[model samples]
Target: MTQHQAADTVVIGGGQAGLAAGYHLRRLGIDFVVLDAQAAPGGAWQHTWDSLHLFSPAAYSSLPGRLMPPQEGETYPDAAHVVDYLTDYEQRYALPIVRPVRVEAVHRDGTHLRVETGAGNWRARTVISATGTWWRPFLPAVPGRADFKGIQLHTVEYRSPADLAGQRVIVVGGGNSGAQIAADLAYETDLTWATLREPRYLADDIDGRALFDHATARRRALDEGRSDTGGVASLGDIVAVPPVRTARDAGLLKAQPMFTRLTATGVEWPDGTRADADAIVWCTGFRPALSHLAPLGLRGPRGHLLTTGTQAIGEPRLHLLGYGDWTGPASATLIGVGRPARDAARAIAALLGNA
Candidate 1:
C-alpha cells in the first residue's frame, strides 16, 4: 500500500524556479507543496564544486521577497554562500518543501495530476514542472572511449584544481564552465581547451553590473516588442577572460579544433592534430530530464516542452519558467522565472475562483 498526499498545486523541483512558483502560489492563497529530490533546498547549486560561484551579483540573485546576504562590495557569492542563502529563504518564507523525495513519474489522471515519488503518491489539481534545465549532464559518445587508458570525467563530477593537480588535462567545450576550469587548472597543469563553436561572447563583469542599466532598458523594449537601441550588448565579443584565452596566456592551454575521434592513447582533432592527455574533462553542458513526463506528449520535436507562447498548452494551469527564447535573454535567468510564476499563479487562482 502506498501513502497518498494532496495539494492544489505540486511543484516538481525545489530549485529557484520551484521556490519561485511556491512563493507565488502561497501569496495567492493556494494550497501547494514543493517536492525536491535533494535532502534540502538549493537544487543543483548544492552539488556544484566548492569553489563555484554565481556570475551574477547578490542583488540580481534574490527571489521574490528573499534577498541574499550582504557582502559589502563582493560582486559574486560563492557556492557555499548561495546554498546558505537558499536555506535561509525557505526558513523565512516558511515554504512547505518536501525534501529527498524523488519523483519517479508524473501523469494526468483525468483532471488531476498524479506524481509517484519515493515517499509515496501525491495527487494535485495541477503540477508545475520547475525541474530546471540542468537536471542531467550531456556527454557525447566518443568512439574508442572505453579503450582509452586515461581517466575521463564530466564537469558535474569535478570538484577543484586539486583533483587534477599535475595532470595533463584536456578540457573540452568552451562554455563558461570550461573556461573557468581551464583558468583554475592553468596555474598547476597543462590544459587544452576545445570547442565545437568559436568561443561565444561573455560580459566582463558577469555579475550583471556591467549591463545592469542597459539590461533594464532592453527589458522594456523586449516587453513592448519595440525596436530600441542602447543597452548592455550580448557577451559575444569579449573573449579574453574566457577559458581558452586564459589558459593560452598561462602557457597551459593549446587551441584544438573540434574533436573528431578518440584513440586508445590520444584524441584526434578535426585539423589532424593529436594530443595525449592524462585526463579529459567534458564540460559539454546539460539537458532537462523530462523522461518521467513522457506520457504527456507535451514536448516539441526537440524534446523541449512546447508552450503556447510561454503559456502552457492544454493546461493553462501549467506554465514553464526559465526557458530560453531565440530572440531574447528573459528566458534564462532567475528574474525570467518570476514572470512566468506570477502569470501561472494568477491563472490558476482565477481558474479556482479563489482570486
Candidate 2:
C-alpha cells in the first residue's frame, strides 16, 4: 500500500519496550513505525489497579531516553504516575505511533514479515513484538473452579478493596502482586493468602533497582563466558514493599499452601481442611500475549518462542521484547526493557544495512 504504512522495522505494542525500541531506532536513524492496540498512550499501566505501586522509585522506573518524573509526595510511583510518564515519553520523542490498532497476526510474506491488523497491513524487513504478558492472565486449572458460586477474579479484574471489603476473600499466588494485593486487603476483608509454597521475601533493602542491577551483572557474566551468577530469581519472590512489610510486621501476611481444590463455598486443602469464601482473587501471573505470532509457528512446548538475545531463533526476521527474562534480564520492567530494546533495534538496523 502507501509508503506511510511500511517501514524497515515495525514494532508491535507501543508500551515500554516498543517505546524504548522506538527511541533507539530513531537514534540509529532507522525508519520504523510502532503499532499500539490501546486507544490511549499508556500501555498496560492504564489497566492496573488504583493502588498498584512500583517496587522501585520513579528514578529507577523509566524508559530509554527520559527519566520518569517523580510522583508528588510519593517515593515509589503509583500506576497513574507510570502512565503519565509513558504518555509523556511517547510524545516527547514524536515516535510515529499508530494507535487503537489490534494486530491479528504476523505471517511470513517472502522476504518481509506481514503484520495484519484490524486497521490494515504493514510489511517490514524486521518485526519486534513487544506485546507484554498483561493481556494473557494465567489462571491455574483448579478442580471445581467452574463450580465455585462466589466471585472469582484475576489480578487484572481487581480494582479497589472496597469492592470486596468485609467479605471472606482468598488471594492466591505468592508473587509481588499476590503479596501487595494481600497486604491491601488484609484488614479490609476476611483475607486468606494461599500460595503454592512458602513465599520468599527479599530483605527490605532490596528492591527493583537491586534486582535490575543483579540481572545486569548476570547478563555481563553470561556474555563474558562465565558462569551465570544468578539473577533476581535466585534472590526471593517478594520485594517486601512498604505495605507488604507493614503487613508482615503486623503478622497479617501469613500464607497457607495453595488449596488442593475449589469447593462451592470456598477452597479445600490437601489436609481436607476447607475455608468458606465469598471471593477468590488470583494473582497467578500472566503468559506472553503471543497469539498474533501463532501464524509464525515458533512457540515451544512451554508456550514461549525460542530466542537468542531478542531475535526469534526460528524466525530470524522477528524479535520478541519485554515478555520477561527470556527476552532480556528484567526486560518486563520499565528500567530493564531499554537494553534489550536497544539491542533489538540495533540488530534490526544492522540487518537492514541502515546501521
Candidate 3:
C-alpha cells in the first residue's frame, strides 16, 4: 500500500505554517504538496481545550492571505473558532494537502530529501518541516514523579474543566497555558497554580497585537544592526486575557512557588509545606516536533536545528518554520507565521532555480 510521490518541494504539516507556505508556493507557481498528519483540517487547533481563547482579535491572529473571520459577539475567538477558520482557510486557498499521512522520518536520498510517511513516501528537491510543537508536550521531571499516585496530565491531554471537576488540582508552569488552564479550573475545581518563578503579568491592555508589534520591531532592530529593541518577553510572561484577568481579579489565580517533588498523594515544597491534590496538570510547554528529521543528523546539543532564518544551516535544502522566534520573530503565531512561510517558499524557489 506504500507508494512514492514526487514534488519539487514538499511541505510537511498542513497547519497554519504549512498552509502559509502553501499559499506562497502557489503564488510563486512552485510544484509542491502539503502533507498533514491530521485526518482533516484545523491542525492542532482542533485539539485545544474547550475554554481556550486567542491572545488577540481574529483579524490580528490571521494567516497569510486571509484574515480569520471574527466570531460573532466575541472580541477574542475561542479554540473552536480558530479551528473553523483554519478549515475554511484550507478550502479557500485550495492547498494540495494529503491527509492522515504521518511523516515517520526524513532521509537524504541522493540530491533529494525522502519523506517517509505512514501512507506513502515523498521525494522532493526541498522540504519544509512545519510540523510544529503541539505533538511534543514537555513535562518536567520532578523528583518522585513516578511515585505520584494521583492523576497527572500535560496541557496537550487536557480538554475541558469538566474532566477534572471537583478535584483538588495543581496546575504547573508559568506560561500563558498554565495561567489560562488554571483560570479555566478556578471555579470548577480546588485549584492550586504553581510556577518555577513569580508570574509576570503584562499590562491589562496588552494583547497579541501588541506582542506581535514588539516582536516585529525587535526583528527589525536586529536586521538593522541596532541594539536589541526587545520583544514580547521584554514586557511580561502572561497576557491578561479575559478569563485570566477575571480569575486574577477574583483572587483565584494566585500562583505558588513550584514544589520540589511529588508525593504519592500530592506535592511538597522545600519549605516543608505540602498540599494534597487529586491531580496535577502540567502546563510546562513543548519541544519542537522534529523527530521526523532526526535521520538528517542536524539537531544540536539542545535538540534544535541551527538555522539561518528559516533555512537549516547544516542542510540548506531543509527548512524549518513556525517553531518559535528562532525560526522567525513570533513565527509560532497565526499572523507571525506568514512572513517565515513566505521566506521559506521563496528560498526553495530560488534553490530550485524558479525564482
Best by TM-score: 3
Instruction: Report every candidate's CA lDDT.
Output: 0.72, 0.92, 0.93
The parts of candidate 3 lying over 4 Å away from their true place are 1-3
Superior by TM-score: candidate 1 or candidate 3: 3
Prediction 3 TM-score vs. true: 0.98
TM-score for each predicted model, relative to the true structure: 0.87, 0.97, 0.98
lDDT of 1 by residue, 152-223 (tens): 988888888888899888888877777777677777777777777766556444444444445656767867
Query: What's the lDDT for residue 191 in model 2?
Result: 94
Please write out the lDDT profile of model 2 over residues 245-354, one tens digit for every residue.
Answer: 99999999999999999989999998999999999999999999999999999988578999999999989889999998889989999999999999998898788894
Minimal lDDT window, size 10, model 1: 323-332
Model 1's TM-score against the true structure: 0.87
The lDDT of model 1 is 0.72
lDDT of 3 at 49: 88
lDDT of 1 at 318: 60
Listed per candidate, the RMSD to the true structure in angstroms reads: 3.4, 1.6, 1.4
